[model samples]
Target: FNPKLRELILAGKTQTLSPKENELLKMLAEHKNDLLPRERALKKIWGSDTYFNGRSMDVYIAKLRKYLKEDSNIEIVNIHGNGFRLVAP
Candidate 1:
């Protein structure tokens, strides 16, 4: 979690993250392997749990997954109707 530069260092490569992505990543990292509920994450980062905001968050999750793919042990798992869990092995 490189908040200062909005980047993620993985597999010896530096991948930059958007402001929103950084915030989301930071939140997920804080929880690490725990489950972060959809409503909880939405309200924290997006300030609401509206339908559109939910959709936007999903897109951000996809982006994070792609960014961390180079590292086999790092993964963002969706908890179905819940939210996400960042698994760091």
Candidate 2:
């Protein structure tokens, strides 16, 4: 792993995270304030877009939100029927 990535992982204070949670946070950090499409997350992380997978993604999203709650400027906003945006200010 790159030293910078290691530092970021350490700074996040994440000892361990589920696969979905780790991928979600990685994408969010990559996009930052940009929109992160739901379909993209589903396809990339879960590898499918079935109803069950969608629900699982929701669970992961909720978990990420909880983990990032300490940063007031960071938020995961749902763009009803569209996607989510990880806003950082």
Candidate 3:
């Protein structure tokens, strides 16, 4: 994934992501194998972690999952009431 280009090259296919998606993915990549607090991501990317913003972040998470699904070894695991972690090689 290239943050500057907002490009994800998966399985030899290229996918372009939205600005927010790029930001969120970049943040997750930074925190790969570590906990990325939901509040932290919301505030950093969405500017605030309101109910609506939290819900919006969820949607983005699902989208990110779709984009990353081509890779069987990578996962965005939910920490259930805490945060998320990017599990990857």
Candidate 4:
């Protein structure tokens, strides 16, 4: 993950990320293997925890999952009504 470039390199391939994508992924990576609270992420990254923003986050999460799909060692676990966990070796 290169925040400067806002891109992710997995399996020798690079996936350029959008601004929100980068921020969300960067936050997740920072908390690698730990829970990143939904409220925290929404507030800090989206500037609000509104329902619409939360839905937007879900979309970003799906995109991130697609980007990381090739790597078996990495997983993004959703904590129901809580947040996300970036599981990686």
Which residue pairs show backbone clashes in model 3? none
- For candidate 4, the lDDT comes to 0.91
TM-score of every model versus the real structure: 0.89, 0.75, 0.92, 0.92
**Model 3 C-alpha lDDT versus the unseen true structure:** 0.90
What does candidate 1's lDDT look like per residue over 1-89, in tens digits?
A: 68889989988999889888998999899899999787887777778435454667888999999988999899999998888999996
Name every residue pair that clashes in candidate 2: none
For 1-89, candidate 2 gives per-residue lDDT tens digits of: 12234222333564456655777778877778888888888788778445554756788888778767766767899888878888887
Stretches of candidate 2 exceeding 4 Å from the true structure? 1-15, 49-52
**lDDT (tens digit, per residue) of candidate 4 on 1-89:** 89999989999999999998999999999999999999898888878435464777899999999999989889899999889999998
Top-lDDT candidate index: 4
Provide the overall lDDT of each model, using Cα atoms, as 2-decimal numbers. Answer: 0.87, 0.71, 0.90, 0.91
Candidate 2 total steric clashes: 0
> Comparing candidate 1 with candidate 3, which one achieves the higher TM-score?
3
User: What's the C-alpha lDDT at position 83 in model 4?
Assistant: 95
In model 3, how large is the Cα lDDT of residue 43? 80
